[model samples]
Target: MRPPSRSSLILFAAVLLAGCASTSSTQTTPGSVPMTQDSTPLVGTDWRLVSAPGTRAGATLSGAGAATLRFEADRFSMRGPCNRHTGAWSRSGDQLRFGGEGGAVAGTKMLCPPEIMARETALLAAMQQPLTMEFEGPFLRLVAGDGSAWRFDSRDLPPAEGRERIVQVAGQRVPCTGAAPMLCLQIRTQPGAAWQAHYGEIEGFDWQVGVEYVIRVREYTVQDPPADGSSLRWVLEEVLERSP
Candidate 1:
């Protein structure tokens, strides 16, 4: 058999080089990690912002009024320092996108204080950017393309089927006018709110006059009651603290 001609050899070499280039293009490059198949760690988790570009380190939604992100299926909802906003969200590999103009966020239109409104604005702006996610144990960090980063801590939600809700409340005792003159706990749900009378009494709690208390109570709805009676019952779970 005769050896291949010089032109034939050149043609074969070109085809071999082209094939190599095509295969290289399809393979993962150096330092590039393939996308993970399991997104279980991210979904169904409640993430509370702990740090952000302009916010203090270890900041919390509850500590700074209220801000939280709950992801479910293809959507997400957040309660900012003042208002609640929700929009669609999608994930591709490590990239996450929050809906923007075409997928505008709809929220409650409650007028809030200037400071709270400002925080909400900043948070909304951050959500509009494209983010890359990283998970570290119970913490999740999102870094935007612009170098803005947000760190969040995981907070597992309680079972939804139960009718009871346990919460911490800060309040004082005040005189209340009822069928019989009585004392009521004047509680404030958030900061900078006027103290309002909580007509319901804390079961198993012995109220001391003129004292303030930060207490945890289990509130449950009454199955049936008198038409003029309160439908919710507050049972003292624990006394967090007491003050004058």
Candidate 2:
């Protein structure tokens, strides 16, 4: 049997830990929070970091934010270096908030690289207050009170009209270094070729993790772009085959 995904393990652990905490606590648990209209976009969603302003994305030592934030029911967990930090969360209007022990996550610690350790500390501190939220399709950006924003996507991305090619897409998305810690597709040009992480968009195609695909794509040179941006663009022309 295949192993469970990181998300499944984190979720299972979160659920088990949350249940234990609730039963063991003597303090009054907050009453059932009424569903808020503003939270519809976030609830039951798993957001992976696409970029962050303060801490560098793809930084092995760069710290400043959680790579993944999952909202399940009224509770959530943010994946960190030392631990998976779990907390209570709520949204109202333009703000989303977290609840924790004494304004910090409660957990045993592990030693990591000094820089990573420090970033983890800063990341937890940043979450102590409320953050504003924005969304565009599969992408979601959460901005802290200090304007240190974290951008995430749980996929817009037009078709290209240049040279066409056939590629095979893997069944899973891997963590890649793009502008940030990216959840990207693994694709290869030849049948026996090693898969390479694709950080660009596949225009006009809806690609899902755990689904393998053979596709036709058009490639073109990107016009003037930022120094760090991709020089070439690939747009989806046709999906030749899909395997569940």
Report lDDT (CA) for all predictions.
0.55, 0.58
TM-score of each: 0.46, 0.42
**Alpha-carbon error at 135 in model 1, in Å?**
1.2
Q: Ten residues in a row with the worst lDDT in model 2? A: 1-10
Clashing pairs in model 1, backbone N/Cα/C closer than 3 A = none
Question: Which ten contiguous residues of candidate 1 have the minimum total lDDT?
Answer: 14-23
Alpha carbon deviation, residue 9, candidate 2 (Å) = 20
110-226: candidate 1 lDDT, tens digit per residue: 544344456667766666655787877677778877777777778553453324332323444678876567877777544335667777777877777655555445567788966
- Misplaced by over 4 Å in model 1 are 1-40, 57-60, 100-103, 156-244
The best candidate by lDDT is 2
User: lDDT per residue, candidate 2, 11-79, as tens digits?
Assistant: 223222221211213322322332343343565666766565544344321122235777766567777
